[model samples]
Target: MPALSPTMEEGNIVKWLKKEGDTVNVGDALCEIETDKAVVTMESSDEGILAKILVEEGSKNVRLGSLIGLLVEEGQDWKQVEIPADVGVPSSVASPTPAPTPAAPSVSAPPKLQHQPGKLQVRLSPAARNILETHGLDPSNVTPTGPRGIFTKEDALKLLQEKQKGKPSELKPVVSPAPAAVPSPSQATAVTSYSRPAIPPISTPGQPAAVGTFTEIPASNIRRVIAKRLTESKTTIPHAYAAADCAIDAVLKLRKELAKDDIKVSVNDFIIKATAVTLKQMPDVNVTWDGEACRRLQSIDISIAVATDRGLITPIIKDAAAKGIKEIAASAKALAKKARDGKLLPEEYQGGSFSISNLGMFGISGFTAVINPPQACILAVGRARPELRVVEDEEGNEKLEQHQLMTVTLSSDGRVVDDELASKFLETLKANIENPMRLALN
Candidate 1:
């Protein structure tokens, strides 16, 4: 299997686009692989005839560099291809020492499988083997449905489901006794006042109650990695948080003006532009924590958090300090669409100097976000709400005025960004947001 991402150690085969005996060419998609981040298509790098498949579809956690299939040169007889003894062995496993070699013969014979009497020779996929071994099931009992009588994972799951259905349920229905004579209204009232209500039986402190059945959904490769990384960030990194409320009335006005000119922009687009401008002004906040030292970045690449069906992913806007508001909006829209479609390439989502997670559209007033590792800080934006504030008029008369205010929180790694630095970053961000016309001037 190929490593689809930088941190990907293993991959799951979602499906194979090509089958055995198919003509393979350069740039032909061989299969769709589920990586630690997304589902990506694996393309062929060489021209050959697909001879054999060692690992089948639905196989998970196949290690990198492991043999998944075989390809032979064009014009060669694919049927005559020899299968290696360790076809499915992981690349990390040590190879056994070779025995003493005998003198080569002038002529070589074709390889063949050795079969014994009373033994069933069944071809089982890797996933099917795992299922059978885990349940201690006999392979001979399962009916094969794959090509050449191969027992697939689907067949194994079907057999297990059938066996479960065959077993009788242990819990029997309770038989209720006949109801007593109905009580008068007065008697019912007295009984209600004196008698305690019926309460369901509760399980013990250590054990859970058998309330309802739930389906066991397997975690996808992306979800697993997300869980691991977030856990690590929370446990290993010392995080500090700072928040500020910015008046967004000017930003909203700017959006309206831009819309009149046939240029559509969003509140998030203005925020992104403001963040890039603030990062450029304060380079100390735009840094990452290397193992040995804190490295401040020269360019400001902003990673925008996007929610997908699989999980949360961050697609980056490179050199945001140089891009205008229109360019930033277009880029964010395209990247978000690609992110939701799970079609982001490694470079599109990988590196960034900082991150921004906006829950403004979701109507979240305020929330703290976990800091993505290696990066020093992440900015969390909340929804904009109208608030009445007391302001003094030119004649020294107090009056109430309404303003659109948004709350923003910055999560920082204390080791890289101290309390003062975090406060300064938020202060600058607040200024740029409140006065968004400064973004165009910069």
Candidate 2:
């Protein structure tokens, strides 16, 4: 499977668009691959006949560069093509023995084990199985609490906890129970009351007790990847943050003027333009750390962080320093749409010299964003709230004036961008944003 995203090590085959023995042309979509970031269509780059389908649909975690299928030339028999034994093939297609005749039962079908009446099959989810194995519990004895009488992790955990508390399993005995051991309804209710976990009283006086049950759904691939990357970033990267309160009255004025011409612009678009100019002015801040030395990029490709249903993906606006404010605005809008739709290609989201995350539209005052790997600096944009400032009048008299103040936090990799360099970059960004007209020239 092709690595559709930068951090994608494996991909899940959501569906196959083409079947075996199909005549596939170049640029044809062979399958839909669900990567950590999105579900992307994997198009074929080479034209050939799809000879054999290896990985079946819904197969997950298919390693990158592994053989998933065969594309053979016309007039060539695909069955004659010998696959090397060392090359790992998908489990669905790899077979050592010859094919069985149609009379034989399908070997691919899963074998079902018979159970006693009213007993459930010993099927457990990954989490449930792990919990049971870890706690030395048998799956056959554990009660299935999930939908359709399937065992769930919560059921396994609750059973383990109850056993530790000296409570017997609630499952009915396979054999007939003795009459003396049978508990009455009152006794069973008392036992349940004793086994139930204690709930602390509400801190507020005269408040009703709250009751609830919760289910733990497995995390999506994107969420898991995000967790892993964020954990690594927090632990490995030495981050230093610096904040600046920018006076954006000029930007607001410019935006209003632009709106008069039917050109819509957002605070984030201005921030992106200003950041690009600042990066161009201070190239030292646009650098990444290599093990041996700091690697500085020639072009300023700014990654704009966009949150989608899958996760947060940053699509790059390449050569942002060379693009105008209007162009940046248009590109940013299109990129954000593409990101949400999961239609962005690898080159669009893979690499960048810097990143900008704007929470201003959401009315956030200020917050720091974690620096994406290989991007030395990330600028976090907050809402531009109006603040009263004391100003000098033409007569030299002091007067109060309302100005829109925007807070921006710069998170930089300490190894690549020192405090002094980061401070200079933020200062330049503030100047550019406050002046507003300077961005027009660039």
Candidate 3:
């Protein structure tokens, strides 16, 4: 399992394009790995036959450098090859054993534990243990379906599922007793009622009450990664926010004029370019917080946050400060396309010195975004709306003026970018954006 991204500690095998015994050549896409940001193709580095697939597809959180599969020369009898002990396969899967029979179980009762040698020493995966404990089930009652008689989470879940199907919806404790413990006529006929806990109705105001039960949909790999990163950013980073109202009347005119020249651009493209230029001017605000030192990057790469059906991904535009307006606009379009298609390479979405998250297209007024790690700041862009303001003319007569106003919020890492530095960065950004023509030269 190779680290697909800089922030990735583990990767999920989305799918394997090649199966065991398939021929592989250099540059061949061996599998798709779901990383922290996007699904990337893992290419084979050498020509060989796929000898084995040790980790199954859809297996998640496999550690970096863990053995995922093997490659061998042609006609090498790959079947005879021995798998390493540390290849991550559980011992139970490596060697199968028959499940021990319940010694004192009644004919019609659930499986019961018996005093057997090594029974108390059964090995279980963390997932299996958690599942067993959560469902109030016992590992001894679950049949070992993993290699070397190891109890696996899948085995526990299977038992629980089967029990749910055979028994009541409410799980009951499995008691080891004789089948003849059946109650007599009057005892069996006794009325019993269970008091159910009050359930709060799930509904929206002004809407009709819900009539049907809603099913829980498991989060996708991308959604899970988003949740984890957002949580970590909020919990670990000491974030300082600074907001500024910028007049974008000049930018609006510039965009229209650029369209006439066939250099079509978006507000977000301008924002990204402005951000990169400002980072170059305010180098101190572009540094990252290393545990021991402040690491300032030399390049002015900017991460542009793009929302896709899967999740949010930030594809980097490397050295945006050196690129022209047309170049930046074209690159942003291409990167956003690749991000939505899940084809962004590791280098395209990995490291950057700053980030731009634009929610203007979504009609959001303004919002403070959590900073992406290893980058000191993130610029949140809001919609440029028309607002009325009073202005004094040359004659000193007060007049109501309409201006295109936009609210932008900058979220900075307090460790590296202080309040003053963050405010200065925002000020520079506002100037470049408001001037509009200055961006063309930068």
Candidate 4:
């Protein structure tokens, strides 16, 4: 399989657009491959005939550089294409061997041990082994469900859930005794009033319906990577945070003025521009944490976090400091659309120097975001709301006035950006946001 992204070690074949014996041309989309970050379409780079497909659809964890299919010249006999014996078959497609039947034990023979110390009798898939090891679960406790008495990830997960639910006594529901006779009309009315309808069990497509108190939604490849990376970031990095409330009245007025001319922009667009300008003024905050040293980035590529059905992905706006407000707005809009549609290429979503996460549209007033690693800082933006504050009038009298204010919190890595640097970055950001005209000028 082709490596669709830098961190992609394996991929899932979502579907193959081209089947065997089909004519393939350069730039033709061959299949949709699920990478660690997104579901990306793998396009053909050469003209040929798709002779045979070794990997089937819905196959997951196919290693990089593994032969997935055979291609041949257009004029060649595609039917006679021979499979290479040296090609390693993916585990997903390999046929499982039937487990051997054990011989009957002799009357005098000692009982055979199902499990022995330092060795497990059950076979396990790599994913199943990893899950068991991570949770400190004994392989013997989990029943093998795969062919040839092999344990799978699903088995490991079910065992973990069973363990988490505690013992049988704790799991048993309390049973109420039945009434000796039917209730009267008044009593039945009261019971109906207090009774709640049973909720239907939730289930995902292609998965079995839940038969218990909870439903299990399998984690996608993207979500698994996100979990691993976020966990590492939280454990390994020392994070510091600083927040500032900026008056966005000027920005609102500018947006309205632009709307009249058919030039539309959003609050987030202005935030991106302001952040880029602030980073330009204070370049220290634009650096990333490199092992053995701190590497300052020469360009300001801001990654904007976009939520997708699969997971959250950050698509970068390259050279944001050099782009105008309109340019930034346009880029953000297009990138967000691509992210939601899962059409972003690796370069479009990788290697950003900084990141901005805005939950303002979701009605979040204020929240701190985790820093995207390698990059030193991430700015979390909250929704702008009208607030009453005491202001000095021209005549020097204090009066309460309503102003649009937004809360922005900066999360920085202490290894690269200390508390002092984080505060300065937020201060500069607040200044730029309060006076949005400076952002346009810059």
Best by lDDT: 4
Residues 338-387, candidate 1, lDDT per residue (tens digit)? 99988888898898999999998999999999988889999999999999
Model 3 deviation from the true structure expressed as Cα RMSD, one decimal place: 8.1
Which one wins on TM-score?
A: 4
Q: Which pairs clash inside model 3? A: 92-146, 92-147, 92-148, 93-147, 95-148
Which sections of candidate 1 miss by over 4 Å?
Answer: 86-214
* Cand. 3 TM to true fold: 0.75
lDDT of 2 at 182: 64
- 111-141: candidate 3 lDDT, tens digit per residue: 3222335444445777766665556565665
Q: TM-score for every candidate vs. truth? A: 0.72, 0.72, 0.75, 0.79
Worst 10 residues of 3 by lDDT: 109-118
lDDT for 252 (candidate 3): 81
Arrange candidates by TM-score, descending: 4, 3, 1, 2
Query: Which residue pairs in candidate 1 have backbone atoms (N, alpha carbon, C) closer than 3 angstroms, thus clashing?
Result: none
lDDT per residue as tens, model 2, 125-241: 777766655555655665455543467777777776665666656433345446666679888766643354653322222444455533345566777888887898888899999
Q: Is candidate 1 or candidate 2 better by lDDT?
A: 1
Greater-TM-score candidate between 1 and 2: 1
lDDT of 4 by residue, 126-179 (tens): 877776655556656444766446788788667656656574421213356786
Q: Which stretches of candidate 3 lie above 4 Å from their native place? A: 6-10, 18-23, 50-136, 143-157, 165-216
| Every model: Cα RMSD to truth | 13.3, 10.4, 8.1, 9.9
